[model samples]
Target: MNGANMSARLKDKIICITGAASGIGRATALLMAREGALVVATDLQADTGAALAGEITQTGGRAIFLQHDVTDEDGWREVIAIIRARHGRLDVLVNNAGIGLSGPVVEMSLADWRRQTAVNLDGVFLGVKHGLPLLRQSGGGSVVNVSSIAGIKASANAAGYCATKAAVRQFTKAVALECAAAKDNVRVNSIHPGIVETAIWDSLIGTTQGARGTRLEALTAPSIPLGRTGTVEEIAAGILWLASDESRYVTGTELVIDGGRSIA
Candidate 1:
């Protein structure tokens, strides 16, 4: 469908996305804005987040940037309060901020494991904890927690990352059930994205540019059944579906946007 003719699926919805400075988070924010949602893009990279917000605004979309550290409880409180004060309600919350700490379990330090858990798992918990009330106030909403394909499958060196993502999957279901039983109209679901072309890989591979492409291709050739890595936009599309009313009946489920990798 043409951009102009496409339906504004999330029209007027107030959406908050964490870790939106770049990667899947940034892509999702842009897509959500295109669908007519007012996006609050948050991240630790203040400059990059502001640039993303500017890009959206220049494209005639509504968006604002907030410097946030999802691991901090006070940061979440401030973000939700701002949302409540400015928009008075929140229609969607995308827990998209995360980190990658890869190494053999025995070789990994406790500090490294905890840091990864804090960003990937604890952050999502806090987002749901603080964002739920605004969603409930909105009369109904959706929560899209970005898990990883590793959540469903084990990787030899990614034990910590996999564990945290698995926790997100279960956490999503529990919250989904809680909202359902309360009849609060809030739906919760997790999105499992496989290898996507994003900055996250920089940490995983220990490089940001140059030889990164060769390393990525070498890494994905056999692992991803699609014979290629997924794109941020591809994952964002799934996220948009979950966040919009199009997936109103979907809750407590995992939307796997991998390149057929998890099954393989």
Candidate 2:
């Protein structure tokens, strides 16, 4: 390893993150790069994802951006194959791509529910199913699934979103146990972030504090025990620790970065 990499936490680690076009995914991609990982940042939004990859490289970090649709199985295959070809091994997989669909359960259409489920739950499933082998080939790795506070705590008008995230939470635990049982040395976990202002909110109707049409601050501040929304960088830091060797002994656990919203 180079002198700078010798002391880096994720030096030489081959890391892949989905939904890297914006929000938490973008923040994580940058953070992982800063820690010496070669980042594969994929997203459905090609332009933004490519920009993220470019930014990383221009700043002396290694990254590649691929246009990816998390709901497509073939996309997952192609992505994993590309990584295997380029790096020959996978060290970390961050299933951070998710969508937020709101409105009352009755008002939500079947199509909307399925779409939400496909992106939020199935995306994480496909990530684990496809990425696990390469991680195993690398001798061991970590999979960080980005769930939400909704997964831990329910709210009105977000039934579809909540259901999918909750599934991710339990699914993560089950997969973690499967890895442990097989003695593959792979660890799987989930992150539940509270009210952080991100692109997801652009489509998400604020359901907190009954302030449906209020500003983001008014909707989030009073409800959160910390009196503020969480930041994408804060969430990224937690993900970095889980991805690095620092959390070697942690698995099948949730690292909630929601600033006490889950408890409140």
Top TM-score hit: 1
Candidate 2 on 1-264: residue-level lDDT in tens? Answer: 234543478989999999999989999998889889999999999999999999988888899999999999999999999999989999999999999988989899999999999999999999999999999999999999999889989999899999999999999999999999999999999999988777688778545433533567787789888888888899999999999999999999999997788888
- Give the winner by lDDT: 1
Question: Which digits, one per residue and each the tens of the lDDT, describe model 1 over residues 75-132?
Answer: 9999999999999999999999999988789999999999999999999999999999
C-alpha RMSD for every candidate = 1.6, 3.4
Q: What is candidate 1's local distance difference test score?
A: 0.93
Clashes of each: 0, 1
Candidate 2 has a TM-score of 0.94
lDDT of 2: 0.91
- Candidate 1, residue 169: how far the Cα is off, in Å: 0.6
Which stretches of candidate 2 lie above 4 Å from their native place? 1-7, 206-214
